[model samples]
Target: MLLEFVVEVPAEQVRSEVEKAYTVLQRTARVRGYRPGKAPRNILSHLYGGRVHADVAQRLVDATLNKALAEQSVQPLSQPAIAPAELRPDASFSYKARFEVRPEISGVKWEGFEVKRPSVKASDEMVDAEIAGLRRKHATLQSPDPERPAKVGDVATITFKLEIGGEFLDQKEQEVETELGSGHLFKEIDEALIGMNAGEHKDVRLTFPAQHQNPELRSKEGVFHVTLKDLRERIYPEVDDEFAKDCGEESLEALRASQRAKVEKELTQKASDAVAEQLVMEICKANPIPVPPSLVDQQAQLAERELLAAARRQGQRLDSNADLRARVRLDSEMKVRAGLLMAEIAKEKEVKVTEADIEKGYEELAEQSGKNVAKVKAEYRDPKKRELLIGMILEDKILDMIEAAAKITDAA
Candidate 1:
C-alpha cells in the first residue's frame, strides 16, 4: 500500500516550536547592547525571525509527519517525499508526503512443480583435470632454451610499451611475464609474441575488443612495441608417491581417491545449487507480484557495494562504468523479486526458522571459519545482522522444502 496524504501542524504547536527556537538563539546570538548569551527573546526574534520560523517549521513537519504516520498505521518502505511549501509565522503549515508500504501476499504456489535435477557423476577425466590444476599450482618454472622461439606453453618475459592512437600508454616500460596463447593479451598481440625468440623486438598493431576491461580502450586500435627478454616453461612433478606425499596423501592411490572424492563433492554441490536456483526461478515465474521500486533501489545499492568490494579485491576498477551500474541494477531487481517471492512462499507454507536452525547456521559458519561458536555469536552481535542471518536460514529451509516436494527429472 502506498499512502499519499497531507498533514498540517497546528498554529499553537508552530508557535511553541518558534519560542523554543528563539530561546536557543537567545543563548547563541550576540547583541551589541547586551551581554553575551543574555539577549532578549524579542530582540533575537527580530534579528533571526525568518531563520527561526524556517527551522521551527521543518522540525514541526517532521514531528507531525511521524505522528500522522503512526496514527494512520502506515509503514513506509522509504523516506516520505515531502512537497515543498512555505512556512509563515501567522498560520499552520501543510505539506504532502508520499511513501510505499509492503504489499500483502497470499496463496503462493511454490511446490509440486517439475524441475530438472542435474545428474552429476564425477568421471576419471574430471578428477584428472582437478589433479592437474593442483599440480600446476605446485609446478616449478624452468628457464627455456634462449635459441628456441616462444611457444603456446612457454611463458615469455617481455618489456613492452603500449600506444593507443599514437599516444603512449604509460611513461615507464612495463615488464610482464605471460603464457603465450593464454588469452590474457589481445589475440593479435599473443600471436605476434609467439615465434619471437629472446632479444627479438616487434611492433604489433591490434584493435581492442568491444568488451575490453577498460572502457576507454574498448574497440580502439593500439600498437604494442614488445621486446622479448626471456622465455620460461612450467615443469610439473611426475604424479607418483612423492607427489602424493607432498599433497599430504599416503600414496598415489590415496591421492587419486581424495581427488575423486573432492570432485564428486564439488559436482554434487554445483548440481544442488543449479536445481535450487531453478526452483526459485520457477516459483518467481509462476507467482508474479509487483515489487516496490524503493526495495529494488535498495537492493541495487547493496549489489553495487558488493560488486565494488569484489572488484577492489581483484585490483580492478569499476566505479566509473555506467554500464556496470545498469547491469547491477537489473540483476538486483531480479534478486529482490526472487527474495520477495521466496518470502511469500515461506509465509504461505508456514515455514519458519527456529532457534535450533539459527544455532545450526552458527555452527556451520564456525566450522567454515574455524572459529568457535562463541566467537561467531560475538561477531554477529548486531540484532539486524542476526535477523538477516535468520532470514537467510528461513529461505534455505523454504528452498529445501520446495525441493523435497518437487518432481525431479534428469536433464538431457
Candidate 2:
C-alpha cells in the first residue's frame, strides 16, 4: 500500500513559477542603493535566489500534486512525504512523493467456510456464583468481638515501628490496615498477627525482600514493634426477600430469575462471538493479503491509548515503550487486514446503508445511553462521527450476510 511517485514538472512551468516568485519579491524587497521595485533582476536574484527557488518549489507541488494523482487515478490515505529538492531555472523540478494508499485487492474467497459455534451454556451454578458476587458487593464490614483474636479472612488495623540495620524507616510509627494471612505487609508479619488479640503488642523479625520498591529496605534484616489495634469481619446479607429488595428486585425468586436470564444472555452472546471469530479467521486464512502499514500503525496507536487510559483509571503507570508496541503489532496487522477484506467483500455484495439504517442506529444509541433520540442525533451531527456510525452499520450488514451463509457447527 506504500507507493513512491517520481514527479517531474516541465522546465517551462518551473521557470513560470520562479518568475512569479521573483516578480512579487522584487516589488517588495528592500535594496541598499535602489528604491523598492527598481532593482535589477540579476541584483535581486543574487540576494534572494535561494529563498525564491524554495518558494517556487513548494508552490509547484501544491499546484500540481492533485493533477498528478488525478492522472493515475490514485487516492492517497496519508499525507505525502515530499522529498527534498530545489527548483532550478530552465530545468525540470523533480521530486519524490511517498504515501500510503488502499491496497488493490484482486479477489476474495469468503463463502461456505466451515466454522464452529462453541457449545457454551449457562448453568445453575453460574447463577448462584453471580448471586454470591452480588452479596459480596453489598456486604458490610463489622467489628469483631473484643475477646476474639485476629484470624485469617479478618481485616486487622495496627501500628508498627520498623527498624532495619539500626536505622528507622519511618520517623514515627506508621498505621496500616491489612488482612490477616494475606501477606499484604510481609509473610512474617501476617503470620505473627494470626493469634494476637486487639490491644496486644508483639515483636516480629523479617528479612526485607530484594525486590521491594524502596531501596532502603531491600534485603535487610528488620524488626517491627507491632500492636494489633482492631479487627473487622466482612458480613454478607442472606439471599432473602429483604436482600432482594435491597438489590432492586421484587423478591428472592424474582432475583434468581433476573440473574438466570442475564447469565443465559451473556452465554449466548459469547457463543455468537466465537462463531464470528471463527468465520473471520477462516476467511483471512483462505485469502491472505498484505495490510497497509499506516492502517496498522493507526490501530496500534488506538490500542496503546486505550491501555494507557485503563492504567490511569487503575492508578498505575504504563509507558508506551518499544516492548508494548511490539506486543500489539501483530494483532494490529491482523485487525487491519480483516477490516480491509471485509470492506472489499461488502463492496462485492453491493451492501449499502440506507437512511432507515441511520435512524435505527440513532435509536439504538439512545436506547443504550438512556438519552432522547433528538440528543443522540445531535451528537452525531459531526460528519466524522456520522461517518463512523455509517461504517459500523455497513460492517454489521456485511457480517450478517457472511454469518448467515457460514457453515456453523457446535464444538464438541
Maximum-TM-score candidate: 1
lDDT of 1: 0.84
In the range 288-309, model 1's lDDT, one tens digit per residue, is 7778889999998888889888
Q: Using alpha carbons, what is the TM-score of model 1?
A: 0.83
For model 2, give the RMSD to the true fold: 4.3
Which digits, one per residue and each the tens of the lDDT, describe model 2 over residues 1-412? 7888888999999988888888899899999999989999999899999888888888889988999999988998888999956678889999899999998986788878888887566678998999999998899888875468778988889999988788787889899998777656788899899988899999899988775556877798999999999888889999899999999999999999999989878878899888777777777888789888888889998988999899889866577778888988877887778888889988887889999999999999998899999999999999999998998888778778888888888776
Clashing residue pairs for model 2: none
TM-score for each model = 0.83, 0.81
CA-RMSD of model 1 = 3.7
- lDDT for model 2, please: 0.87
Give the best candidate by lDDT. 2
Error of 1 at 267 (Å): 1.6
Q: After superposition, how far is residue 381 of candidate 1 from its true place, in Å?
A: 1.8
| Residue 363 displacement in candidate 2 (angstroms) | 3.4
Superposition TM-score, candidate 2 onto the true structure: 0.81
Where is model 1 more than 4 Å wrong at Cα?
26-49, 84-91, 145-147, 162-172, 206-223, 311-327, 345-350, 367-375
